[model samples]
Target: MNFSSKLLQNAVEEFGRLPGVGKKTALRLVLHLLKQQDAEVARFTSSLNLLKEKIQYCKECYNISDEEVCEICLSVKRDKSTICVVEDTRDVMAIENTNQYQGVYHVLGGLISPMDGIGPSDLKIEGLIQRLRQGAVKEVILALSATMEGDTTIFYLYRKLKEFDVQVSTIARGIAFGGELEYVDEITLGRSILTRVPYERNVG
Candidate 1:
């Protein structure tokens, strides 16, 4: 790729550093940005700079927020007794989108993946344990992803919380609503059969 200007090349290289962005895509983005007005470009750069400088992590859950406590943690409507443990802020957002769970969240920051050199000590496990020890929480929901790493983390957490009085539960895993048994993976299909729930009608 032949970039006439070093400034343009630098911008393209920086954009290319982003995940899933190829050099060609980065160059295209840089060219697009170059075509924008100076004021528009300033606003774009300013927003990015502001995000980097002003974004805060909730002290309680480590979720991204503008304040010390996130809106979810501060909400009085949320169930303080039920803490849904998740891998990251994305999981927190995903569950929130459903509007089904009214419980508070505990973001682990990451899973315990030995291959990735990530362990319990590297995550927010200590903070979660401390929060539980305070006695306000009655149930700890392990909402980690359905993977080997997720299973390992859940098992490790179960062992840790065994002495605690809090009830431990996992989100039900099963076939999708419209999925056929033949298409569903063996592990999920088997678990779905074993943990089948009664078909209850919604009143509303």
Candidate 2:
């Protein structure tokens, strides 16, 4: 796309770097921002800068937060004994929208995708194992997506946690194969969480 100004072209290029954003969409966004008041644009840029500088991953669960520990981990109302394991912060938000789980979470950061060069050692699996060893957790819910990578991660986690006294379970197959938690409807996701089965039964 041709631009009258280098500054506008630079902004569009930067916006295009975002996932799912094309050059046309990025140009549109840049134009929209150009129409906004100077103060409004400043606020928008300032918020993004602050987010980059201030965002912190929760030391306990690896979830994104503003402090050392996430608000969910610190909540007294959450079930400390049940840890719902998910892929990332987006999945955490998806499950929270269902209002079906009271348990705390353990964000795996990402799945074990060999094709993508991600492995158990690259994830936060060791932290999860350490939490299990602490003995406060009684159940570990594999709330990962129904993708192959998700299954691989769950299986790896099961093998690691088998010696721990904690019960390992997986969300019901209400979600179709290859389905991502973030894209599923709230009711179906909530039911899946409610109808989770033992890891042994799920695999058997």
Q: Best lDDT goes to which candidate?
A: 2
- Candidate 2 lowest-lDDT run of ten: 170-179
Cα deviation at 23, candidate 2, in Å, is 0.7
Which tens-of-lDDT digit does each residue in 1-204 have in candidate 2? 778899999999999999999999999999999999999999999999999999999999999999999999999999999999999999999999999999999998999999999999999999999999899999999999888999899899999999999999998677776899899999779978998878897678
Clash pairs, candidate 1, are: none
**Tens-digit lDDT track for model 1 on 35-152?**
9999999999999999999999888888889999999999999999999999999999899999999989999999999999999999999989999989999999999999999999
Please give the lDDT score at residue 175 for candidate 1: 88
> Per-residue error at 80 for model 1, in Å?
0.6
Provide the lDDT at 105 for model 1.
Answer: 91
- Residue 70 local lDDT, model 2: 96
Least lDDT summed over 10 consecutive residues: which range in candidate 1? Answer: 195-204
TM-score of 1: 0.91
TM-score, every prediction: 0.91, 0.84
